[model samples]
Target: MKKQFLTLAILSTPLVANADNEAVGTPLTAPPEIAAVFAGSAGTARTAEAYDVSPAELDRAIATFTNGMPGDSAQWAVALKKSFTAFEANHPHTFGAALGAFLFNNYLVYHDLPLDDAADAGMKSVIAQYDRLVREHPEDYAAADKEKYINMIMAGSYAAMVLHGHHQDKSLAGQYAFLKSAAGSALENYFKVPVDRVVLENGQLIAR
Candidate 1:
């Protein structure tokens, strides 16, 4: 059954649980107007899928999308590290590829993982790459767009991290608290104010 489930999960249409479905997880809800901006930008290989991905790469991407920094925080961070390294090796900018790397790698910051030198370097590289893209193509990525994408991903990732942390060990109250605080920051930063209420659609914020 375990093997069957794994294969099915991999082969299926990404197995994404709706954000509003508490059975899968509690996603961060943001103001409708603000949430709409973020729903368009989160996720690893899905939202930004222009690059050619191998079967193994596809598997990893599926894991990250469905798992969302659960027990696999360390593994997730490591995979993202390797992705960034390969992107750097390419020399030429594949905008979608770089953007995907940046979006996915940034989620690692919220995961409870100890990033080694390589992983740390990878994180820095993605940040640099994202910044360069923004700078070089302000017309494509305006300041508001950059802020929206970053905050939207942050809100969603931190919310998932908080849920996972609590589920893994109820005793780790401190960690969960920290994650909630981080989620709050992401919400406020993106909305430009603390949102009192939010609406979600398909795990993305629809209305506040």
Candidate 2:
């Protein structure tokens, strides 16, 4: 009976981790230096320094998601959302790119099989939800939010694909080439800028 119960429990366990299933924990804090860089108050050198810390902070969040106690992942998600929300309030013009960078770096971290699989799955889930939202309540899907949703989906899906290539030991040049192309395409589509005018500098995409 014990063996049967154990088998049943194991079988019932989910193969993929869901961020929603996790409880919210401590809020993730964004360092002031990062905010300074986003605000254009910091120098180019400081920009590099601040961005260097950003990845580490994101990794800390990922660590909490994967290894910390139950609800830690959800906590980190909520915390990051809040942190970015506050940052966005202050740096309205640059916040979208900054958020894209956060998603890019966060998705780049390599995780074990199912969790890594979840990265792509999560993007698909976003697409499905957005589709459902638009289908069921067209009025609620405002034009501005529509663009925002599309941008987010692109950033997330691109990052997930890049991470997948990284995990497979794909060529570094190929990965970056794809990223640059994606960035250029996004700028062209959303901002109506010529792709040639877009440049990647210090990990940020800038449109001239």
Candidate 3:
């Protein structure tokens, strides 16, 4: 059977600044409203049925990712990839929104930023890393991996839009359009593809 790959889900944890100035991880609780989103309760757009992954399972995966973190971005990326791969191997459904929720919470905690700021910065950081990998390390990214990463980033972006719309009382269409434009621009810049080649639909990224 073909396995479905999902995006990276980060666990929300308090990080202490260590001697090396790296964020050391500790368990942190997310706000109830935000946690509800991770539990697949934001709306029809965030339903577990929508992604084919149970909320409990996604929570388990999030915990696994959180507990495994060694701090710092490089190590965090490694941990995120490992967690994502493991979840993909075991689950029949996707968990991109769960991953997005984790990442969104982590950014809020790590940056001490407001929701809007955290979402904006966090999504950009993820897309930027993906862009760098495909542009500067094509030999390492691979085609399959590239597709998975793109899906994950876009799914994550969709989750962010859901959250923004829920909390900020914004229009989902507007949020999606903004995110799509940003992601489309990145794809065009890195792969020389047309901005319309990849599109977000029903909370997932579809590549043409």
Candidate 4:
């Protein structure tokens, strides 16, 4: 059915729901933005040519897309962990109800997806878990975090790949830069996270 869904729209995972439980620094916090990683942005995988994708080749493609190039993945994982921790620490929620509503609304994005009953049911189950957690532990999580996280997702989701002015190449880095810049500003100003774009690799903020 093609699912007609993005990750948020499916609610298969809550991006920052359990963020506080993980000691604020862990590998699970970072999954490379898939669309960003697949920046070639071509639908040309489908051609009139005889596609020789067997079960094994299909599996291999999925694995490569999921785990990425193994050695470089570790480096990105560490970067994502550090980056997310710095973001959350600088933003804390003042109202519990707002946090609950924010998470609930985020899941509702998936209702717009075109899905078969089984897929919809599965997605609903996932959302239910997040709703339960957010409702039960409002003190442990924050609305500010949810807002910032959603903003990041929305920005990335909206920023799709584009053919680079007749070059036929998609700019993966451009999408990343746009997402980072948009989310960075939103986290800093809207959500009151003290994020500086110029943070040093040592986790120290630069003097503005």
Top-lDDT candidate index: 1
In the predicted model 4, the residue pairs found to clash are: 9-110
lDDT of 4 by residue, 1-208 (tens): 1221112211112223222331111112222453333233223211112122233543333344336433465553343333333323322222222222222222222122123455435434433343444445444332223323333322222221111111233345554444444434322332222544222222211212
Q: Is 2 or 4 the stronger prediction by lDDT?
A: 2
Candidate 3: worst-modelled 10 consecutive residues by lDDT: 1-10
The alpha-carbon RMSD values of the candidates against the true structure, listed in the order shown, are 15.7, 20.1, 17.3, 19.8
Best-matching candidate per TM-score: 1
Off by over 4 Å in 2: 1-158, 161-164, 171-181, 200-206
Better of 1 and 2 by lDDT: 1
What's the lDDT of the predicted structure labeled candidate 1? 0.36
Which consecutive 10 residues in model 1 have the weakest lDDT in total? 1-10
**lDDT computed for candidate 4:** 0.29
Candidate 3 lDDT over 1-208, as tens digits, reads 0112222222221111123321222223444632433342222221122233344554454454346443454554444444455534443222323333333332332222345443444444443333332244323222222223323433443234233443455455654444444433333332233545433333322234
Error of 3 at 179 (Å): 18
Residue 141 Cα positional deviation in candidate 4, in Å, after optimal superposition: 0.9
lDDT of 3 at 72: 58
- Model 2, 130-169: lDDT tens digits are 2332244322222222223222322343344444444565
- Model 4 ranges off by over 4 Å: 1-4, 9-115, 143-146, 152-208
